[model samples]
Target: MRLWQRIFLIGLVLWLATVVVTNWTGNSNLVPTVVLFGSFLVPVTFVVWAYGRGRSPRVTVELLFVAFVVGGALGVLGASLLESWLVHPSIGMYVVVGLIEEGVKLAALMFVTRHMTKRTTMDGVILGATVGFGFAAFESAGYAFNALFTSEGLSLRQLVETEVLRGILAPVGHGLWTAILGGVLFAAAGRLTTTVMLSYLGVSLLHALWDSMNAIAIAVTLALTGHAWQFALLRIGRVPHVTEWQVHVYTLVNWAGLVAISLVALCWLWMTVRSGRRRREILSQ
Candidate 1:
C-alpha cells in the first residue's frame, strides 16, 4: 500500500529467501547477519528519506519499490541471457545491460516521484541510493550464496572480515551509481531546470562505465597475455569454490567504483542545489 511498507515487505521477502536458500544449500551459517542488514538498511533508509522529500503519491513510491525488484530481476536475467552464448558472461561487453537496468530503475523512480523543484535534491540522492540498494540486495545474495555453498565454508575470521568489508561497501556499489540517475533525472523532469537531461545522461554514462570497467580490463588482460582461450572474462554463475586475486578484483573494484561514483554524484547534487538556491535568490530580488 504505502511505499515504505512495500519496500519493507519486498526486502523482508528477499532476505528470507536468501537465508532459506543458503540454509538448504548448506551455507546457512555463512550468512552474516550484519552484512545482510547493512545491505538492505542503507538503501531502504534512502528510500524513506526520499519519501519525505518528494511527497510523492503513495502509488508512485510503490512503483519505485517495484522498479527495484523488477529491475534487478531483469538485469540479472539479461546478463545471464547475454552470457549464454559466450564462454562466460560479463557486464562490460553489453553496456546496454547496465544502461537498461539502471535506466529502468531510475525511470521508475523519476516517473513516480515527479515534481519540479530544487528542493527535491536530497530525495534524488536518496532514491539514487535506493536504486543501488535494490541492485545490491540481489547481487549480494548471489555473492554470499557463492561463498557459503561452495565445498567448504570460509573460516570464521575470513567470514567476519569479508562480510564486514562488503557491508561497509554495499551502499555505494550498484545502488548509489544508479541513485545518481534517479537523483539527477528526477531533478531534471521535476525541476524544469535547464541541462537536467544532459546531466542525467552524464550520470547514466558513469553508471555504464562503472559496469564496463572490468570488461575493459579483462580485454586488456587478454590481449597482453596473448591468450586464445577466453580466460580473461569472469565466469558468471560459477564460483571457483574459493576467493582468488581475480575474484577479489571483481568484488572490490565494483565496490570501489560505485563509492567513487557516489562521491561524484554528491558533488554534482551539491553544485546543482547551491546554484539553484543562488539563482532563486537572484530572481527573488
Candidate 2:
C-alpha cells in the first residue's frame, strides 16, 4: 500500500477508537469533542496544507500519518498511566509526563522514518510535528471533554480557548521541539552513528524541562501558601497588569514565547535544505 494510504488507515482507526471509548462511557464532553476533531482533523489538514505549500513529500505522507496514530496512541496511554503515579502535584509529574509522551512519540517517529528511500531534513521535522500534533490534539480534546462533563452544557469557550492556544502555539505538545530532533536525525541519517540517539534524548529533555517549569511554579505556590485554598484564593485571585487585552494575557505570553522559538527552529530547518534544493535545481538546469 502507498504511504499516504497507510497514514489514512491509521488515522481512521484512531478516530474510531476515540468514538468507541466515548460511546462506552455513554457520556459526551466538550474537550473530548475538541480532541476528536483536533486530533483527527488538524493533522489531516496540516498534511494537506504542507503538501499545498510544496514542502512535504506526498508519496511519503503515509509514513507521517502512521507516526501520528502510533505516537498519539502511546502519548495517551503514557499520560494516563503516569497521571496515576502523580502523588505529588509538583514539577516532577509534569516533567515525567512530558518526557514519557515525547519519548513515545519520538520513538514512533524513528521507526516510521527508518531506512526510507527518500529522506530529508524538512521531511523529518514535518513527520515529527505530525506525531506531536496528533498527540496534542487528542489530549487537549480529552481534557476539554472532562471539563464540559463536570460543568455546564459544554465549555465551548474553554474548549475554543485551549484549542486556539494549543493549536496556534503548540501544534502537538512538543511539536517545535521534536521538529528539531527529526531534522537533525534526518540530516545525519547516513553520516552519523550515535547522532540519532543524542537527538532523541535532547528533544525529550527539553520537553520535560518545559513541563517542569510550569509544575515547579505551581508546586512552589502550593507549598508557600500552606493550603490549596489559600493558594487558589490569594495567589490566583489577583490578576496582574499586562499589555494586550487578549484572552488570558498569561497564556498569550507563553504561547508567544513558544511561537518565537518555533520561528527560530523553522529558520534552521529552512537553511538545512536551502543549499541542497538549490543544488538539485542547478543540476536539473
Predicted structure with the largest lDDT when compared to the true one: 2
Q: Model 2: per-residue lDDT, tens digit, 1-285? A: 654456656665665565556556645553355366544555555554544444654326566667777766676676677667652566366556656666666666676666576666667667767666667666766765554543455544454455545555554345666666666666665243486666566566556655554434444444543444544566767643323432244454455555554565567556655744665577579
Best by TM-score: 2
TM-score of each: 0.54, 0.61
The CA lDDT of each predicted structure is 0.56, 0.58
Which runs of model 1 end up more than 4 angstroms from their true locations?
1-38, 45-94, 114-119, 151-165, 191-197, 215-263, 279-285
Candidate 1 residues 1-285, lDDT tens each? 766666666765665565556556756454665346535554565557555655644325665676566655555565455545542354444455555555555554554454434434445655556656776666665565455443564433343344445656665566656655555554454553556556656766766766676665544444444322334333443322322554555556555666676687667666755654565578689
Candidate 1: global Cα-lDDT? 0.56
Model 2 error, position 63 (Å): 2.9
Model 1 reaches what TM-score against the true structure? 0.54
Cα deviation at 75, candidate 2, in Å, is: 3.6
- By summed lDDT, the worst window of 10 consecutive residues in model 2 runs over 239-248
